[model samples]
Target: MSLVSPEYIRYFYYGAIVIMIPFIISDLLKKKKEDKIDGTKHFKISVYNILIAIAMMVVLFFLINSNYPS
Candidate 1:
């Protein structure tokens, strides 16, 4: 009954992750010239974001698989 298929949604989710990773890396690696700070803060935030994204993606994969006809 849904307008969009789960396969497309899954692909979109993956595409989003692909697009997001580069920006996350950029944030992690970019110099903080204004505050003269190092990258520890960015590293922690980037790691947290990556972990959360992986967990969510795993959950999404299971949810999508469960909805498919078996």
Candidate 2:
């Protein structure tokens, strides 16, 4: 038998969701700061960065959950 708190699961799930809005907002601000960006550049850069962030998060979650490089 196992018991996990609802609060624990909520934070784990919604935390990831909550993170994405700020990421997109920051990306928008970054592009807005650039005076000479072409139309697709902002979207492209944001997509790339978001993907990288996701990859890193996945890696980190696994690493922290399990022993690695030990």
Candidate 3:
């Protein structure tokens, strides 16, 4: 091993980044009739999603690490 394996945070980072595409697409097509176009809403949603991803990372890391002890 060269150094610390980023495998620890790899899943989380990739997953969170991957979600941006769908989020952006939805935001672009979202209407203002039923729901006004609110940049704030999208921003908040993204932040919330990021936080959830981080939390999930912790859970996943532990869950996976526990199975394969090094």
Candidate 4:
């Protein structure tokens, strides 16, 4: 049995999103409570997190789509 099967990779992809949800939510909540002066900092962090998540998804898609011998 291969460790890098599609099923396992799919699970990992889902898990990564699930893990990222809390960080996103917290960043939003924090941004809402902060003053305008600090808004840009929080916004930058939120955007960075979102970009990283997107990059991860793209990488995972390629990993899942690639054909490998079992």
Q: What are the root-mean-square deviations of the candidates from the true structure over C-alphas? A: 5.9, 6.9, 8.9, 6.1
Best by lDDT: 4
| Number of backbone collisions per candidate | 0, 0, 0, 0
Worst 10 residues of 2 by lDDT: 35-44
lDDT of model 2 at position 63? 84
lDDT of 2 by residue, 23-58 (tens): 878867878666355544665677688799999999
Q: lDDT of each prediction vs. the true structure?
A: 0.70, 0.74, 0.66, 0.78
Candidate 3, residues 1-70, lDDT tens digits: the string is 2156666577767777798879765764563222454434654565578689889999999898795756
Candidate 1: residue 62 lDDT (0-100): 94
Worst 10 residues of 4 by lDDT: 35-44
Q: Give one digit per residue, the lDDT tens place, for model 4 in 5-38.
A: 8658877888888999898788787785773756
TM-score of 2: 0.46
Q: Report the C-alpha lDDT of model 1 over 1-70, residue by residue, as the tens digit.
A: 1256864887787888899979866765663332246424655665687799899999989988896776
Q: Is candidate 2 or candidate 4 better by TM-score?
A: 4
For lDDT, candidate 1 versus 2, the one ahead is: 2
All candidates in order of lDDT, best leading? 4, 2, 1, 3
The TM-score measured for candidate 4 stands at 0.46
TM per candidate comes to: 0.47, 0.46, 0.39, 0.46
Better of 1 and 3 by lDDT: 1
User: In model 4, where do residues sit more than 4 Å from their true spots?
Assistant: 1-35
